[model samples]
Structure formats: C-alpha cells, structure tokens
Target: MGLNAPLVSPRPSDGYDHRFTEVDYLRGMERLVHAVQELSLARSLSDIQRIVRTSARELIGCDGTTFVLRDDGICYYADEDAIAPLWKGGRFPMTTCISGWVMLNRAAVVIPDIYADARIPHAAYRPTFVHSLVMVPIRTLEPVGAIGAYWAQERAATSREVSLLQALADSTSIAMENVRIYAELEQRVRDRTADLERANEEIHQMSLTDDLTGLTNRRGFYLLGESALRAARRNNHHCLLAYIDVDGLKRVNDELGHDAGDSLIADVSEVLRTMLRESDILARIGGDEFCVLVTEPGGDTARLKDRLAEAFRTFNTTQARPYRLSASVGLALTHPESSHTLDELLTLADELMYADKKAATESRAGGVNTG
Candidate 1:
C-alpha cells in the first residue's frame, strides 16, 4: 500500500480533527480569506487559473498543482503550475482518470499511492514525479472543475491539507461563476448597443428621404445642395437650380385618384433622374414641386429640361397610363462670380417657374392651365 491506496474523506469533518493548532488555524483562515477576496477581481479564465494555481501549489506545500475542468462528458486537464512539468494541457476521459473519479463522485480523494488506486492509470504517472496527490471537486453541489495538489514523494495527506484544497476549489467555483455572469452581461450590452445604432441609422435615413418616391426630400435637398454649392463656388464652377412643378398633379388626383397621382410623381422622378448626371442633386421639395442642383462647371439647363420633357413624352406615348405626365421647369444659374446665396437662387428659379406657368395659362391650351 506504499503509494497506491485510496483514502476517501469528507474534509474538516474527517477523522483527523486534532491536526491544527489554534494559532495555525487562525493564520490559515486569514490567508484563505485574502486569496478568496483576490479571486473576485479576476476578470478572465486565465486570471482565475493563475490565481488558483500559484496559491494551491504554495499554500498546500505541494510540488505541483492542476485545474481540471469538465467539457461535454470528458474531463479536460485545462491548466497546471508546478516546480517540474505536469499535465497542464492534456485531456482525460471521466472513466479512467483519478480527477475524473472525484469529480464524477462529487467527493474528495487523498491518494497516498498513485499506482495502487484502481482509478489511477499506472502509465500516466510513470513520466511525472507526482507520487501521491489529493483531488477535490470544485463544487459540492454540482461540480464543474476539480483542483489537485500533487506531492513528489509518497506521503499521507493531513486532514488540514485536504481541507485547504477543498476550500480553494470552492473559491474557484465562485470566481468562475462571477466571471461567467460578468461576461454574459457585457455581451448583452454590446448586442443591445449595436441594435440601437442600427435603429438610429434607419431613422436618420428616413428623415432625409421622402417616403413616397425614395428620393431626397426638402430637408435632404437643403443639406446636400448647400454642400454642392460650396464646392461649386470653391472650384469656380457653374451650378443650375431648377424649380419644377408637375403639370397636372391636382387634375390627376381629382380624376384618377391619389394613387395615380403618386404613380405620376414617381414617373416624373424617373425622368428627372435620367436627365441629370450622377453628381447632380435632385429632390422632391413639395407635393408636386421638385428642385435640382446641377454641379458641372458648364452644365446646360436647356438640354436637361428638353431631355426630361422628351423622356416624359416617350414614357407617356409608350405606356398606357390613365393620364399623361408633363412638367413646367424654371432654371436659375449660379457661377463663381455670383453673389447670390442658395436660398436667393432657389427663389429666383421659383419666380421663373411662376412666370412660365403664367405664360402657359394665357396661351390657348384648353381652359388656361390653371394653377
């Protein structure tokens, strides 16, 4: 029974009650409290390992220490610290390992002979200097991991020694629990924060865009048009502001219903989109009013107006819609030498649009295209 016998015990309540003196007991308690307190500050699994491994190896007067955790149904030899090399990164199954037996039984075992115990595999200890050891389940309730203290020479483990190791195991359980809870909380906050950012982005996009046509609304027009104006002014370029009104939006709304009016607005937007370059700014400013900022150095407003009119004519002739679509456009130009602001430029375009509307009303085009 030299170094292969099993001695199972329930710790401090075990048969070796008279082992510790009053002074030694108090000193051990003080050290145990300090160690357990430090475990709370450990933020990671590695931190927990470093704290437990060093403390167990030193406080228990052992040559080495190990922290074996259970993963799935297998016992994982997760970590260790020793004066000599130990099983720091090896794994063992629950069926044949001593650490597994203690964990499986949810009990503590002090082995004076590693070769003698049925649970101990002979070949496993042949390479190491661990002749005897004490292993304790991390939790008495539901064990997650185990802590082991290994001795170089065969010796009977004192009741005090096994008790301290059990205490360390229990402390580790609490420390790991704290780390798990903290990690879960951090992940949840991160996920929630990401969700909020996405929602805010969607809201901001909605604010800048018109719900009907998926086009830039008045607010978006002002913001983007201002930036385009600044760039044009800096680069000594020409900028065109076009004020447009759908020719028969109200009549279409009255005759064909609001849905037809909406369809007409979308069709007009498509024609306007095709008339401008990618760098141009187009926005639906009001019910049937739109604005455009052409950003080229020498843009042709006449050509753009003609193209939109032609596109509308082509679309109206090709598609059999309830009503034809047409637009009355007004153009105002801003160059580098111009002293007018964006608001003044837009006002000038609107005035030109009203003048065009007045002229068209006076012409004999049916009952005077009334405003």
Candidate 2:
C-alpha cells in the first residue's frame, strides 16, 4: 500500500490506552480553551484576523493560514500570506470551491484526504497545492464568513484539531459582530450631529428675518449695520445708508385692506433684493419703511436713486395689484472726521426721508399736498 493510503492502527494490550492517552488529550484541550478565551477579547477585525492567523498556524501545524470574509457572493481574503494567496480576496464561484460550498450550506467541511474524496469536485482543488483541508462556516445569528486550514501533503485531520478550529471560528464570528456594531454606531452619531447643525442654522436664519416681507427685521438690520460700519471705519472705507419710506401705504392699506398692502411690500422687497449688489444689506425697519446699506467707492447718490427707481418700475410692471409701489429714499454717507453715532446718523437719515416724502407728495399734487 502507498504511504498516502489510509492506515490501520495496531490494537493495544490495554483497550483505553489504544487511542490517545487521557492526560495528554486533557492538556491539549486546556491549552485550546485558553487560546479561545484570549481570542474572544480582541476588539478590532485586524486584531481578530491576526489572532486567527497565528493560532491556526500553531494549532494545525500548517505551513500557512488564511481568513476570508464574504461580501455579497464574493470571498475576499481580508488577511493572508503569500503561501496561500488563493485564500486572500480570491474569487471563486459558489458551485466550484470547498470554501464557497461551506458558506452556502452554513456547515463545517472536513476533507481528511482531498484526493480520495469523490464528493470533492476536481476543479475546486486545481488553483492551489492544498491536499488536506478543513473548512468551518463562521456562523453568527446570520452566516457572516468562513475560515479554512489546509496541508500541502494529503493527511487525515485529527478530531481534536477539528474541534479547536471550530472554537476559533466561533470566536471570529463574535469579533466580527462587535466590529460591525461599533462602525454602525459611529456612523449614526456623525449623521445625527450633521442634522442638528443644519437645524440650528435654519433656526438662526429665521430669527434674523422679517415675517411680513422675508427681509431683515429692525433688530437684525441694526446688528448687521453696526458691524458693517465698524469694519468700514477700521479699513478707512466709505459706506452709504439709504433709509426708505413707502409714500402712500397708509392710504392703500385703509382702502385696499392690509393683505393688499402686505403683497405690495413683498413685491418691493423682492425688487430691492434683485437690483442691489450681493454685498449690500436690505432691511425692513418699520411699517411702510425699509433701510439699505451700500458699500462702494465715490458714494454716487444719483446711481443709487436710479437703481431704486428701476426697482420700483419693475415692481409696477410685474405686480397685478391696483396699488403702485413708491418710496422716498434718504441717503447718508459716513465721514472719518465726523463724530456721528450710528443712532445719530439714523436720525439724520430719517429726517431726510421725511423731507423727500414731503417733496414727492408736493410734486405729485402740483405743490398742494404736502403731508
């Protein structure tokens, strides 16, 4: 008979001693149990894979060992050495290989002698020089991945060796679960933090905007205007503040209802937002009143007035309502040598606005109506 053929052991004089001696078997089992306990404490996947590689190499006395994980239907050798390159991220159809078959069935496969087994398909063993193989499905609540060990020469795997491998596979399953749970929890935390930041930003924006016309309210205007004035002063730059008042809003509201008046205000706000440069600030400071801060060189009042007039004309053409959109604009320029507070500047601008309103009304009624 060939050396590769199955051997029949001689019968011992003592029946119990014929098999493995009790003391030797117990010592081996104790060592395996300790090894499993050590593997269970591994926190990360890399740690678990390393433990698996080292433990398998020692326990099975194989030339090399590999650990693979199943992603979709494909097996990737998450950790392996060159001696068993086929085990590392190597692709094999489920119908063709021992590892794939074990994964599909969710059971352990022991090939005592790969060459002698008829159930073992020929094509599966063609990629590597593996002759003796033991594959165990690393089963969790759901099947995760698989672990396998192989010998270069054909041989029978001892029962104790198979038991140790199964224990190691179980340890790997638990470690994989821990790592997956940690990763998912970390992702959830990041998603929640991002969602909260978005909500806070929206709330902050709502607090700064006027409810009536979707423009910056009085409080927001003062806060922003003061900041802009300070910045311009520090940089030795010029800024223009234009205070505007709707000429006949009270009459329009009394005759056409507050809803129509509100619609006209919204239309004006949209026009001003569109006509001004993105750097300029447009704000609603009071009923039928708004303010704009324009930062530009030369401080051209005529250009600013023309832009306002164009915006008014656009609103008149686009709006379907009967009431016309008209505003009296009052502009003030900041000077470095002047000792004018923001409140004082605002008062001057307000006085100028009333003067413009008076002139506009007088001009409209041919110097008769000067309210």
lDDT of 2 by residue, 21-119 (tens): 334345545655666776667667888888787777666566557787777787666775436555565766665667677788887777757877775
Model 1 steric clash pairs: 3-113, 3-114, 4-113, 4-116
lDDT score, candidate 2, position 115: 74
Tell me the whole-model lDDT of each prediction, alpha carbons only: 0.81, 0.72
In the order shown, what is each candidate's alpha-carbon RMSD?
A: 6.1, 6.4
Model 1, 230-310: lDDT tens per residue? 988898888899898888889999998999999999988887787678898999999999998887737676776666667
**Clash number for candidate 1:** 4
- Candidate 1 residue spans exceeding 4 A from truth: 1-28, 121-127, 231-238, 270-279, 336-339, 355-371
Highest-scoring model, lDDT: 1
Candidate 1 all-Cα RMSD = 6.1
